[model samples]
Structure formats: structure tokens, C-alpha cells
Target: MTAEKALLGCMMKENHLIGDTIIKAGHLADPRHQALFKQMRDRHQQGGTIDLVTLSTTVDLEPFGGISYLHDLQSFANVEKFAEYEELVLEKWKEREKRNILTVAKEEDWEIQKVIHALDQINEAKIDDHIAISTGLADLYEAPWQEENQIKGISTGMLRLDQMTNGFQDGELTVVAARPSMGKTDVMLHFAKQAGWNGDLPIIFSLEMPNKSLIQRLVASTGAINRLKLRNPYQHLTEAQKEQWPELIGRVSETNIQIFDGAGQTVAQMRAKVRKLMHEYPDKKPLVLIDYLTLIRPEHHYGGNAHMQVTEISKQLKGMAKEMNCPVLLLAQLNRAVEQRQNKRPMMSDIRESGSVEQDADVMIFLYRDAYYDQDADPKHLELIISKNRNGPIGTVFANYNQFTGGIRDAHD
Candidate 1:
């Protein structure tokens, strides 16, 4: 007999339903197996669903083994009985858990089983309500004040934004808005830099900028140089600014910053990519920076709604931030309607076509530049207009914009 069969013979109990091991050694090495294991590990770590398309790279089943083989082998490999496998795994875990104090649920389960030992006691205690009773027990461990205090999950970023937010508290969504050439992305990059220092590497899904440009912008921000100047420093800068570029790149390298190459991501596709990154970087409850919210591809058609589709997308992304326990920094475009108004400054009503963008966010911040309007004024003074501070005080904060570095610093108070 094969050594595997001999091992199984000794391990198998008389009552145990032991299936013969059908080791498709070739299929075991198939990439699907490896991909499946990795996907399973990630899904368990980051509480989310992994659909087949989003779950793995191995699509074709031919390499995974034949249909006839898969049918018989799925049963033999113990794949079909996952519920049973999970129980067995948990039981094994309990056996090894030296600290496990025969939990109250376990005791209660056994108590109910003992009472059910005889048919006469079956109606005495309600077994159908057991799941509800067990789940309600969580209330015993929860503290009312503790629960109240932890209502929002703040993105551990800037004091100004955090003060406005109490930080992007758990389950709350945030949106950042600005006009074209308004440096909306610049502000979000600054926020991401701050988050990185807190050991939280926010994942940026930039469909507008390439990953390298994004890195350069970060390097510029960290260096406090205008990213535009960094790209053409020799053309625009003096010798002193030239000397600062290397030191800037070196400084940004110290932070825990990470970016995803999301050049053409649809909403569904972005979800899969972000979920993978979140799992990979478990400590960084990634702050997702979508360059602007309008470019996102919807999950499905909403009867040719150009505006409502954008609304649905924003609402879903904000919902995702809450469910995944991550802060979503959704960059938005200000409607040109701002340009037509007597006052050019953007308001809550100016978040392009969709009211949902304004409605979905816990905080809405706008970036406006005077240089965009006037020819003579300095471009350095960028205004941070807190259009809607749902949870905190609404106001403006002035920051110095380094045109060369794409960096923002709080202007003189």
C-alpha cells in the first residue's frame, strides 16, 4: 500500500467517514490552487467578498484538471464539505487553545443539548431562538460610553481636517472638491503624506496621473517643491531650488507611502484592487484617493443617467469606506457654474452635477486658487474652503502653495 494510505489507515477511526486521497499531484501544482489559497487568506483578513473575477488570475479550468477529474476529486480533496471542515478546524483550534475558558456559548449549547437528551425537555427551553440569544450576549461586553465615543473613525491626517472631522471616524465618508487646475489632488496628497507618518499608507487610485507622476508629486510635496517645478526644475528654478530636489526625494522615502497603478480602473475593478492592497497592508487602513469621483465606471447602467450614475458611484464608494473601515478621500470637480456665479468660490451646491456627492460625504472641502482667476496675484496662497463640515466647525484655512514643490504649508495666521 502507498505510504499515504498506510498513514490514513492508522489515523482513520471506525466511525469516521474517511474518503480515499485522490492526489491529483499535477493539478495541485496548477496556479489555481495557489491563487485560491492566497485569495482565501486575503478575504478572511479583510472582511469583504471576493467574486470569482475579482478573486484570482487563474480563469481557465483546463489547467486546473479535467471536468471528470474535478467532479470526483472535489469530493475526495474535502472541498465540498467546507462547513464541516470549518467546524473541524475550529475544534482543532479549541484543542490547542490553552487560554480558552469553555466559553459561555459553548456551555449554554451543551446545556441545551443535555436538556434535549430526552424528547420531553425539547419544548422546555426554546432552541429556535438560540442564535438570537447568543448574538444578543455581545451587549454584556459592550460599554455604552465607549461605544458612543468611538462613533466616527478619523483619518489620522491633519489636525485642521481632523478637528473638522474628529478625524474621519469609523463609518463616515469624506469628499474633497476643487476646480480644474485648483490643486485638489495636491491637497489629498498632503493628507496622504500625513497619514503615512501615522503608519497608515493610504492607497491612491489615480486614473488621471500615472504612478510615477504621483510618486514625483509625493516627492515634491514631501520636499515642499511644486510638482510642476520638479518636472522642469532646470527650466524654472535657481541653483538653490536645484540643490533641494535630492534632499526632498530622500525625505519622502522615509514615510510609509504606497500607491496603486490604477490607470483605467472601473468602480468594481477599483474595489477588487483596493481590497487586495488593504489585505496586503493590514496595518494601513488605506485612505483611498480617487483623483476625481466622476470618472468612475458604474457597476451597471442607470438608464443613461450621466449625473445620477456619478451620484450612485460616490454613494457606493462612501459606503465601501464605512464597511471596510477605511477613509475614502474622493476628489471632486467643481461645476463651471462656480465660474458663472458673482462669487467664484465653490459651495456645497457646486459639486458638479450630483447632489449625492455632497450628501454622501461626512466632510466636504474645496480648494480654490486666486491665480486661476487673476493674472497678477501670487499663486502661493491657496484657500482651503471647508464648504460643509457636517461633524465640526465650517470655515477656511489658508495654506502657502509652493509652486515648484506642489506642497502646501499653513500660511501666516
Candidate 2:
């Protein structure tokens, strides 16, 4: 190890290990243990958003990134931290529970003490991404300064938005916004169908529509017919529209898009579902497509201003995108102010009360249709305006939306 790493390691071990530090900082030297500390490092790499039980799982190596150091390394018995002792004990019990100690011993037919040693080695000493961990995390955040992000490929999704932005980049909080009756839900259905069917990914958190309704739209979109038109016709339907349903159903049944349609959910519940998907699809980065932002409610314990609650929620979504290294397409609502404006085009300042919506976003696109204002509108165009982009030029891309088919296709210039 280099001189700096050696020093960091000693500080971590002495301050955290052998002592009863109430609060300490530094990453576990082992990369294998990094995943365990993600939530803590997420808030502030140096400190904050920490879990003692999670940190204790790793070897007491120096924590990395930001302005990290071991400032509070005294024993829990220290006069200053007497009350913290109770908390630490509770955390210690949880850590013990995590070992699956009883189950491991039974499986291996080994003694409890032997299993304990094995557990320590697996949880603490082992490296998650050994090679990467060995390097400083500061190295990770070196800003792509020395390099560029070369995404592997465009995702095989049906929606052209990924094509519009070249697949959601890592570390970005992308927001997709539109008004009611603007084909927002239909677009989401089409997006989910293409993404889930073409790739092996989890299409998470469908917050806007019912599961069955989303499915119907996907099937209808794929078939080139309006879901409502086919399900209920005024008099007689063309023979062609009636025939498209079977073909559409046959095509969509094969994709693996997952949905969470169990009533309204707290942000905590969404996190749990996303975590489950990440574990299940470790190879592919997770994609969370929340139908509409206003529908999301943070857990009850979350306090303070409502807008601030939404802001924190946005940051967390960005954090999730970064940690999972996946494209998150969260659908958001435009403030009624957009309706108040004569232009009706969205602006960053007008994404409701939560300015974080603008700040946290990596890419922001507004869905607009002139037809809503006037049915005589020709070309039936859907305008996708890139209000913000960290990478790529900002502009509008037009696509054709077949309301009758629930279909959105790239429009040729």
C-alpha cells in the first residue's frame, strides 16, 4: 500500500477498532464491504447518513472520499457519548442478526464460534470490488476528469426518449413531464413495453395507472390501435382494427417489465422494491419509471416543509441512479402555471414548488402537443423539448403519436 493508504488504514483501525468511537469516518478498505456502506456514503461521503451496524460489517479500514477523518474515536464509555451507548448496543444486536449465524452453522455442520470467524471474514475482511476498493474512492470521483463516460450502447426500448438522450446516463436524475390527457400515461406504457420487452431489466414503480390499464395500453400500443377504440366501438369497427389485438398480445407477453401497482407507496417502499430488483438483475442496471411525481409520498417519519420533502425525495432518486448506475425515468407533473402561460412550453423555474426538480435532474424533457389546444393541428406532432442537459445539445425532437393506437414513433424531418 502507498504511504497515504497506510496512514488512513491505521487511523481507521485505531479510531474505530480497539477503541469505542461513538462517531468515526473513513471507508472500509475492502471493496466487498462498500455496498454495505452505500446509504451512509450517499448523503455525505465524509460523514452523515451513516449506519453503525452497516459500517461495522466491514473491516475497520479508513473511509475514503470527501473530507473524511476520525474525529470522535473514544470508547462509548466516554462521558461525552454515554447516551449513544444504548444506540450502539441496539445496532450491535442487529449486526449479529445479519450474520445469519444460526443458519450458517447448521448448513456447514460447523461450530458457532467457527461460523462467527467465517462470518467476520466474509463481511469485513473480504473485498467487494477488491481492485476498485484498493484504489482511493477519490479516484472514483476524480470527475471523469481524466476520462469520458463511454456508454456501452443504446437500450433496446420502444420509447425514443432514450434515443433522444442516448439512454439515461449514470448519476443523473432525469424527469419526464407532461400534462393530463397529453398521452403521458400512454407514452409510459409504450416506454415500459419497449424497455421491458427488449432488454432484461426491471421496469420499477408504476405510480400513475393501474397495472391492468398499463398492460392494456402496452398491448394496444404494440397493436397499432386505440385501446378504447378497440374495447368499445360506437357502431362497427374496421376488420383491420379487430385483428390487431392477437398480434399485439403475442408480441408483448415475452418482455420482463416488472410493475409495483399496490396502492400509493411511500418513498421507503419504493426503495425496498428497487433494492430487490437490483439484487435480482445484478448484471443489468436498474431502471425506475415512476408514472407521476406528485403521487409519491415520503415515509410518514419524514418531516419539514412539503416542498422540502419532495426535494429530499428528488435527491434520493438521484442517489439511487448513481448507486445503481442505471437509467431512472421518473415521470413528473408540470405546475398548473404551464397552463397559465400563453406559450404552454415548460421552463425549469416552473416545475412546481420543488426547485430541486430542476437542480437534481441530469436530463429534463417536457412532452407537449399542439393538438390539445387545437384539434385542427396538422402533422399530429409530439414535441420533446430538452429543457436541461448535462451532455448533448438542447432542442426539440418531434414524434408522431397515434392516439388511436397508443403508439409513439419517431417523426422523419
Candidate 3:
């Protein structure tokens, strides 16, 4: 209370102090103080005066101890100690917010994940550190020299695509969109295989497929094993392939990959799970891979408004990427509008509920296979269209797609 009173007093005494501090009206403990601070801040923002004479006319000062309490507050005002009082008020506010969160959680019987997320929200809002433009300019000047011949981000395992994108970057959201059987999942698995092999952790959320199916695809991708042969090895596998099964399975098992095949996963649940993995594997950088977007359950239903739900989910996923300091590779399905087109190639607008997804994505790649629509076209030819690259150029990179094995790889490979 003392800190809040002193801070509000300083702001009222020096009207300019209201704009200098990040303190909000909610930071005040006393109801009257909250109301008074809000009025002062509002008036200052409007370019109006914030003195007692002005406030007394605009606001009912009776509840705020009339003009007498204003004098009492003014007595404690010290513009020189404004920063100290502002910090003290923020500290107390944070403490109160944390306690309130815990109390609400207990009363509502909220899940532990929800409680952690609420607490995290409080921490994220606690501080604002602004840096000068020159600091960023200095780093930008040195970046090219420092990263001259290296991949600046996690490798996508495709040489041409990697050359174009420099791989999926940290603090970014990369969306891979395609029609059914266009190898969207295969492309994600390709990235996961590369990330795992490079000593980075690939955390996969397979909302559409079971863990067993994903493992089969991974084994097929890593070992070049035929997918059908794995289904019924007794009939499809030859003696030579049968003898090689142990090594192929063992190779995939060695990579650091974690798969969650649960349905209706919310972003908060995924965040909590990822946080746990980060604590366990502090040394390994994690790449979060969600099989598809629409399947993700929103925290709150929007009366079946898919667009609103997707908007919320995409925003949260982008936030999660920056907060975790890692890349998030999200798979999405293209709408029927793509099939209606003459070219049948996907555009940003083809994404289902695309408004927010397109806006939130730092990178967007569309997968196209000519053979899917044309029987005479080359089945192995796949075009990875880089439709959007926020940090680099956008172009198409060709890759080999093996339908039999569910594998997507560099064309030259």
C-alpha cells in the first residue's frame, strides 16, 4: 500500500511520470487507489491535466478521502524515488497475482497444467526489457561473418530446401500444408529424422495417427524399409530383409524422438509436457512437431466457430515457440479450393481457417505431387514450394517422394 500510494503520488505530482511507468491500475491493492490511478493515467493519456483540481472535477473524489487524502498522498510524493516505488508496487502485485491464481485453481479444481500455465502468464507479464536499435544493428552486422558457411537453424535434411530456408529457425512457426496423401506427414517425419540424428530432440504430437503407425513410418524413412513388408513380414519379407530387421529397428530406436499419439490435445497440455522434457534434457534443443492443426482442442470452445478456434490455437503455438526458444513445425490440411484450381498447387489461402495461420507462420511450405492427380506423372517427383519465408527468399525445392516407403528426401540423394 505504501509503495502504491507513493508511486501514484509521484505520478500525480509530476504528470509526466504516469507515462514513464509501466504500472497499470490493477497493480494497486486498494480499490480507491486503483480508481484514482486509472483516472490520472486516463487523463494524462488524453493530454489533459492530472492535477488535483482537474481530477476533483472529472472524478468523484469523495470515496478517495475527498481532497484531504489527495494532500496526504502528495505529502509522500518524491519524484527522485519514482523508479524504486514503481518496482516495489510491481513486486507486490506479482505476489498478489500468484496467490490469487493458486486460490482460483484450488477452488475450481483446475488441472496442474492449467495452474502452471496461469502462473507462467503472470511471470511473462512481469518484466519488459527494451533494448536500443544500435545493439541489434551491431549483432546484425556480425551475423553474416559468424554464420557464413553454417546452417543458421535446425537442418530440415533436404539440401535444396535447407539452402533456401537455412532450416526451421528458433522462435519461429513453420507450417507444412498439403492435401491428403501429399506427404505432409512424411515431410514432417523427414525433418524429425534429421533433427534426431543431429543430436536434437524431436517431440512429435501425432494427433491423427497412433504411435505404432508413426514408428513404422519412421523405420521406413530411416532404414529404407518397404512399408508393406513391415505389415506382414512373414509373407512380404525375404530371408535377407528378415535378417536385417534388428539393425533397422535398432537404428531408429537410437534417435532421441518422443511421440505422443493422444487426441484432442490442448496447447497448454502440450506446453506442460514440453516443459517437462526441457527440464529432463537440458542439453538437447527440442523441435515441436504437431501432425496437424485443426485436430488440436482449443482451451475454450468458440461455439463451433472453427476460425476463431484455429486463430486462438495458432497464436498460442507461435507464442510457445518464442517462449521455449525453439522451432515449432506444424502440419495442416489444404481446403478443397486447391482441388478446384486448374494447377492444383496450394496457396496460402488454401489453408483451412487460414487467416490466423497465415499471419502467425514465419515460414510456410506447401507440398505438391503431380502424380497424385496425374497417373502419367513421375511418382517420385515432389515439389516443396516455399510460399513464405520471413527471414529469407521463397522458392521451390524438388525432392524424391517414395510412396511405397512413405519417405521424402533430397532429390540428389
Candidate 4:
């Protein structure tokens, strides 16, 4: 009661300071103080005056004492110390609710509804630390002009791809579709390494591949060593390859990349796991890479249809990326339609099982290698088709794909 009186007094003196405290009228222990504070806060919220004159006009000041009583309240608190008083008031409110909950629990045949309501009230008292966007419109509008906010997108390490999509922006889903052995996994791994090397946390959810295989690919790609050498370095490695192993081992160890071998995992389970990671590393922004969309199971079975399940998973993954405020780099397979066609280039329509994957993606990149189908075709030049780029230009970029190392880099790199 004393703390609440002090806070209300401070607010009366400095009306603008009310916004700094998390305390609400309902949090005040005393009924009279709650009523007075509620009327003051209501006036403030409405953009009306918040002085004693305005407060008295809205809330009756009779039995609670007259206008004189309000004047005397200022002596009880100082405006400079309002935050300390706010904390004190909140603590008292929590204690009062805890006592009420305990009192209810002791009753025989206590209604579950009452207990649940009490617990909910307790939970609502927690202070939120997230910035209030409702009050930051001016800052948000000016953000693009500011140097720090100018480059908001995450870099993909490929110049043309970055230019095409401004890299992958946060709260977006980017789908990379490729036919069998066209290097979908390799492209995403290259992106993951790019983010990791830049000191951001990158997570890989490998539904189609195991962690060991992914690591082998990472080693092969980073070291420029043959994939076969990675599988059994003892036998296949040349003298130069063996000499370079120590440096490559150190490079992989230094990268801040985390992988999840989530074979057959549902989207709901992935959400729960990712949420846990977000909570664990609140400061680090994560780049989520799902190996392939088709392998992920939906939490609720949508009949026995694979396409419908994928559609649901695609939508949910897109939502999850927005909810988690991160970019989701999803790898997917192009259907056999691409193989049957003479062009052999994948389109948005070729995303296997679900067209929703293409619809949900902010950017859709397709990997195609001419060498994959032709014996005399150039193996070094792999084509990356940006079929759909929601934010930037759609075009094709070429990179050198080293099949032995499973590495892809800009052709001119």
C-alpha cells in the first residue's frame, strides 16, 4: 500500500514517467489507490490531461478523501525514485496473488478453473523485456536511413546471389530446389559456413543426412579435399591432402555452427527444439537450415497424403521463421519432371510434393549442373537459377561445383 501510494504520488508530480514503469492499476494492493491510479492512467492513455484537476473530474474523490488528500500524497513519494517504488508495488502484488493461490489450493474439492485462473494471473505479472514496437514507429521509419540498419539481410557469400536477393533477410523462408545430386545440400552448407564465419550462430536440421555425413561434407568443402578422402583419410589422402588435414580440422573446430540430425522429426518437434535454442541463446541470431522439406513430418497427420503434409509443414516452417525472427534456408528436391524435360532446368512448379513451398518462400533458388546430364559438358560451371525473388531481381548465377570436394563457389572465385 505504501509503495503504491508512493508510485501514484510520483506519477501525479511527473505524469510522463508513468510509461517507464510496468505497474498497472490492477497491481496496486489498496482498492482506493487502484481506483485513483486507474483513472489517472486512463486519462494518460487517452491523450488527455493527467493532473490532479483532470483526475478529480473523472474519479470521485469523496470517501477516499477530497482534493486535499491528493495534494498530501506527493509528500509520500519522489518522482526520481518511482522505479524503486514500482518494483516494490509489483512484488507486493505477486505476494498477494501467491497468498490467494495458496488459500484456494487448501480448499477441499477446489475448482480446477479457479486454480488455472490464479496461475494465469501469476504468469501475466511477468515483465516483458522485448522492445515495444507500438511506441517506436518514428525509429522504425528512420531505420533504413541509419547506417546500422542499412544492410539488414544476411550475406549468402555468393556475390550474385546476394545481389539477387539482398542475401537472406530475417523472418524469411528461402527454398533451394535441385534435382538428385545437383548439390542442394552443398549450396546450403556453403551458406551455413558463410554465416558461421561471420560470427553468427547457424543451425542445420539434417532430416535426410546424418551429422557425420554433413561433417564429412563440411570437411571436404572447407579443406578442398576429396569426399572419398574424408570418408577414409587413411587410404585415399595424398601427401599434400594429409598435410592439409591439420589446418582443415582447426578451421572446422573454430566455426560456430550447430547441427541437428533430426531424421523423421515433425515440424512441431522442430519448433519446440528451435524455441529452446532461442531461449538458450537470446542474444545470438540463428540461421535455420532444414536439409529437405519432404522428410519432415507434420505434428498432426493430415490423412495419408504426402503432398498435403508437406504443404502444412511448409506453411508452418515459414511461420516459425517469422516467429523466431530468423531466416530459414530450406533445401528441397525437384521432381522428375525436370529430368524428363529437354531443358532440364528446374522451375517453381518443380518443387516436389508441395507447391506451397515455392509460394511460402521469399526466395526460390534452383541448382542445375549441365555436367550432371552430359558427358562432355563443363563440370566446373554449375547454374543457380533464382526463379523467384520476392525482394530483388530474378536471374541465374553460375558457380564452379567441385564434385570431389562437394564445394561450390562463384565461378570467378
By TM-score, who's the top model here? 3
Q: Please provide the root mean square deviation of candidate 4 (C-alpha atoms, Å).
A: 12.5
Summarize candidate 3's per-residue lDDT along 249-299 as a digit string, tens digits: 887877779999999998867876776677578899999999989999976
Question: Which 10 successive residues of model 3 have the least lDDT summed?
Answer: 120-129
lDDT of each: 0.60, 0.59, 0.85, 0.79
Query: In terms of lDDT, which candidate is strongest?
Result: 3
TM-score of each: 0.62, 0.62, 0.69, 0.66
Write model 4 residue lDDT over 1-413, tens digit each, in one string: 77777888888887875654557777877788878877787778788877678767877899569888788787787865665686577667777887888786876556865665465456334443477776788567877777674555778888887877887788899998898888888888999898888777788899978999999999999988878866678988898878878988889866678889968986656755665566566677788899888888764454576776776788778877876678988888878888788988888888888647878888888999889999799887799998888888898998988988888888763
Q: Can you rank all candidates by TM-score, best first?
A: 3, 4, 1, 2
Q: Write the per-residue lDDT of candidate 2 for residues 86-166, one digit (tens) a residue.
A: 234334433554456667678779975575445434322222334556477766777667777767432524245555577
Model 2 residue 143 distance off true place after TM-score fit, in angstroms: 14
State the weakest 10-residue window (summed lDDT) of model 2.
17-26
Q: Give the per-residue Cα lDDT of candidate 4 at 117.
A: 47
**Candidate 3 accuracy as lDDT:** 0.85
Give per-residue lDDT, candidate 1, residue 184: 81
**What is the overall TM-score of model 1 with all chains considered together?**
0.62
